[model samples]
Each structure stands twice: as structure tokens, then as C-alpha cells.
Target: MDDPQRSLLYRWPTAAKFDRRVPKEKLYEHGTGTPAVREKFVAEVQRITWAFKLAETTINLAGNTAVPEIQIFEIDAKGTNVTEPVLTAIDKAIPFPIIFEINRDDGETRSTRMVAAHKQLGSGAPKIGAYYSTGWQSARTERQSLPTAITLPALYTALLDPLTPMAARPGEDVSEVAARLKAMRKLEREIAALERKLRTETQFNRKVELRRALKTKQAELTMLVER
Candidate 1:
């Protein structure tokens, strides 16, 4: 049985601070004095914060599951529990799948890592007297058996296969809708780029040429959107 409080499989190495120049004695340091480094660091951290916000919906959905566990390792570029403001906000937003660990850098002595390795080798060392499971036994094991999330590609494909809509349209499948949406988004991006270029263009002849190109792109975008 798994402990409810210890379920969230959070893992993060030490935080890497953003420094302008290479430190003489330190791997990374807070950019306190350097304005350029400070600005860059702030921007990068903001970008990461936005990414978490974007994935918030999915994270919330996962949190409601029977054995909920949220992984916060990947999002932390500057180690566990280092940043104050952004992390606090994210923590508040995530009500489910309570955080288990902040710094997972102590893998050298972790028994979970040992169990995972033992399982990979088709050995019964992780558990007592269990052996001879055929063909990639890890995927079939219950969710609570592993400390970390499953990384098998085929298992993921099999799990997500049923989520594919049965009949999206009369003659169209989900993949076609996805492809069409991708193409439409591409055209929209190209149109936006051309418009930005048209704004910066100075020469009269060049502006005229840009206008024609922009018009063509806009027409294509309209067609794609309508389809």
C-alpha cells in the first residue's frame, strides 16, 4: 500500500541561478548587481512560470485521479524551493496531488532507485520471491509499485489510444482535424510575420511588393480558416 501523503513523486536537482559571467568558485549565483543578467534571469523565470500556467489544466485533471502525484522537478530550473514568488503562486494554484519532495538530488542512497533498477533486470531483489514475469513486466505492474512515473512508449500509446474520438466527422478522423489545425496555425503565423515586416518596410517600391505578398497570405489564411 502507498502512503497518501507521500504519493506525489516530486523530484528536482539543486537550482541553477542565472549569473552574467562564470563564477570563480560557484556554479551559479544570484544576479544582484548586473542589470543585464538580472533582466535575462527574470525573463527566463517568467517564461517558465507561464509554461506552468499553460499546463495547469492538465495538471489539475491528473490531480483528481485515485493515486494522484504531481512531478515538479522539470519546471524548477533553479532547484527546489529556491524561488519565492513564482513557486508560491504555483503551489497555491495546485490544490490536489500535494507536493512530496522538494530536492530529489539525494538519489545516491535512495532505495526506490535501486528497486527500479532491480525491476529492469528481471530480478526479484526489489520484492521478495517474485520472478519470471514475461515481456516488459514493469508496464503491467500496478501504479503504486513504482516510485516514478512509467516511461514506456508503447504503454503510453496503448493508454492514450482509446481517448481518440471514435467519429469526429463523417469522413474525417482526429488526425485529419489535428493536421488541418496545424496547417491553419502555420498560415496564421506566416501572415503575422509578413504583416510585421510590412510595418517595418520603408522603401515605396518594397512596401508595394510587401502589400501584394501580405494580401496573398491573408487570402490563404482566410481559406484555411474557413475550411
Candidate 2:
């Protein structure tokens, strides 16, 4: 289970700040090609701001060919929640990896959360993997200084460390962590489906078969979690 109290609000350096507003239409051009995605943007999103740019020039970090810079986009949401498809559209539009700070205003107070996918440069387009997110926290939450790292890629990994479901092993990179999390998600889904089937299963023989399958999937998930 994800720790709801583990929300991290990074104190972005002044040098790395690039507080620019991003137009929703710009995302529509390439990202929200589908009607459903476009509609989600219009309905759920209030505004998009390109809040920061972490790069070699701005932060004095060494440039990496795979990740030259990391972008932070602050999304002002119209409601308490924005769908994942809306986020997926924005990720599709941007070439670089992005960290999203989603803010929502209720009648009494405002809340914020950090969200991002493990993104990598692909041949045609960036390969965006499963998203990791921190639970909603108070907008007034104290911020922590950015994690120390040698390069942009390392910084990106450090930024996402708090959001991932599982901790990375000694030699594991962000990509490896993402892959493991993805597999875990798949196994979780399978287990849920099997459980649902078991609940409705009537025949004794069918129940036995489902039980066996469920046990196998559960064992697989346990191994992944322990690793």
C-alpha cells in the first residue's frame, strides 16, 4: 500500500524556475487527438503552467543525452480530481519527462499532489510507463530541498523515489523500478479478477480450478513484493 503521509513537495531552486503558463490548446494539437481526451481537458483542467525547468544551464548539473532536462508543470484542476487520460495527453505532447503538481481548490482550502510516469526517450516518441503519485496533501505543506545527484537522470530518479510503490534495489535504475512496478500492477489485477470470479463461482470443480489459479497468482505477487 502507498503511504499517504509520504507526500514530498520539492523546494525548486530559484535558478531553475521557469514560471510560464502553458496553453491547453497547445496540448490539444498533438496530445488530445481523441475526442474523449480533449473533453477531459476542457472539463477537468482549469489551467496549465510550465512552472520549472531543471537543466544543465539552470542548475549546473551535467547534461545527459537521454534526459537533458526535467520539466515541472503545475496543473490547476477545476475539481478535486483529474483523470489519468488527461495526464497521458499532456505527457504525449511533451518530449521531456514531466513532474505534475496538481492543485485543487475547495470552498475552504486548497490541496496539492505530485504525479509522474517513468518516462524514457524512444525512437519515435518517448516511452511513458506507469504513473506513480503521492496522495493529496495540504498546499501549505513544507517543502524539502531537491535530492543531491550528479546528473539530470539521477535527479529525476530521486524526484520519483517517494512516489514509487517499491524501493529500488542496490543497483536498480528508475527504468528497472518502473518495470517491476508495472509487473506488480499486472499481478494485482489478475488477483482481483480471480477473486471476483471466485465470489460468483458455483460449480465445485470450477471453484477448485479458480482457487488453484488464485493461489499461484498470489504467490507470484508475494515474491515480487518481497524482492
Candidate 3:
């Protein structure tokens, strides 16, 4: 059986902080510094305050210049008595499905060393998951959409697919899929407003055409989401 506190148990690895330049000798020392202490404080804090454990650390390294960047993605602690690790106000709930990336320091040619990322606007915990699932259900309503939230050939005409896509996927710099989704929503709103306004002004044929288009869109979305 799934753990009841599973939601509290898993979080996106977030709250990243790291010094690009760490003196080898001072490494351990700096690791104990005030900042380091606070970061490490997570452990002690959890011991005294929360009833949770941050079991994973996701690190992503980037940059090629003199300084290299180490991005620390962490799942920290929260709450003291409950089965869940509830995050404090200042402390953030981790993003769902932890993600991050690292790249080699190759002078001019910095190819992909490592890239781990997620798709969707990570809202963290239950809210994020809900948004993700709901978004998919909404998108699935329009399966035939040439330009849908789903990715396809670049040649696919977004104007035809009629749904908004996303922006900045986790690993990639950014994806336009989000943008497409937004655009589709705006278009829908405009159409809806017009329909409401025209209900009294427009004729039956016009309404029929609009209804047909809407049904078609809904059907296509259903196809994409369902299968």
C-alpha cells in the first residue's frame, strides 16, 4: 500500500546555494561556515524540529570560466510530529520529480554534459500535481489540434492545433509549448466572450458553427489526453 504521507515524503529538489570557488583546504572548513552551517542546519533542524528526512541531493554543475557553478537541489525537512514533512513559510516545498543539470567546462564548445529537468510549471506538492494532471486533461480534450500542448513536428501549424504549448522545459533552455497553451487559452476566452455577446446578436447558423468548432476542439483534446 502507498504510504499515507507519501505526498509529504517527496518534494522537488530545490533551495540551491553553493560557492563556485571552494579552496581545497578550506573546503571542509567553509563547509562549516555560517552559510554552510545553515545549509547543513537542515539536518539538525530536522532532528529538532521536523519529523522528516531529505534522502536525496540533486546537483548540477555548469560554466567553463575560472569559476564553476554547483547547483544543489535539496529536499529539506519540515514539521515535528506529523508523518509528513511540512515545509515552513521561508522554506519551500520541493518541486515534484526532482530536476537539475550539469555541463562540462569546455572553452567554446560547451555541449550537454548532463541535463535533468521536468516539464510543466512545477507548483510543488499537491497543488503542482493537481495542476499537471488537470492541464493534461484539459489539453487532451483537443486531440486533433495541429499545434497542441503535445510536441510534434515543428512544421505543425499552431494556429490550426489551437492549443497553447509550454515554455522552458526543465532540461531545455525553454519550450514554446507553454506559450502555445497560453495563446490557446486567450483565444478561447476571446471566442467565449464573443459567443456570449453574440448570443443575442448572432443568428442560429453562426451559433451552430461556433458550437461545432468547440465540440471539435473538445474531442481532439480528449483524444490527446486519453491516449
Per-residue lDDT tens digits for candidate 1, residues 1-227, read 11222222212222321213222112113212245444333543312321111122332222212123332212323322223333333333333211211221223421111000001111221111111111111122233322222322222122212222211233442234345456766777888898899899999999999899889988876665552
lDDT of 3 by residue, 130-188 (tens): 11111111111222311222221121222212121233332322234434444555656
- Candidate RMSDs in Å, in order, are 19.4, 2.6, 17.0
Question: Which wins on TM-score, candidate 2 or candidate 3?
Answer: 2
Clashes of each: 2, 0, 27
Show where candidate 1 strays beyond 4 Å.
1-170
Off by over 4 Å in 2: 1-3, 196-215
Model 2 Cα lDDT, one tens digit per residue, 77-145: 998877788888888999888999999997788988899988877677787887778888889999999
lDDT of each: 0.32, 0.86, 0.29
* Candidates ranked, most accurate by lDDT first: 2, 1, 3
Candidate 3 segments exceeding 4 Å error: 1-15, 18-58, 61-173, 216-227
Q: TM-scores of all models?
A: 0.28, 0.86, 0.27
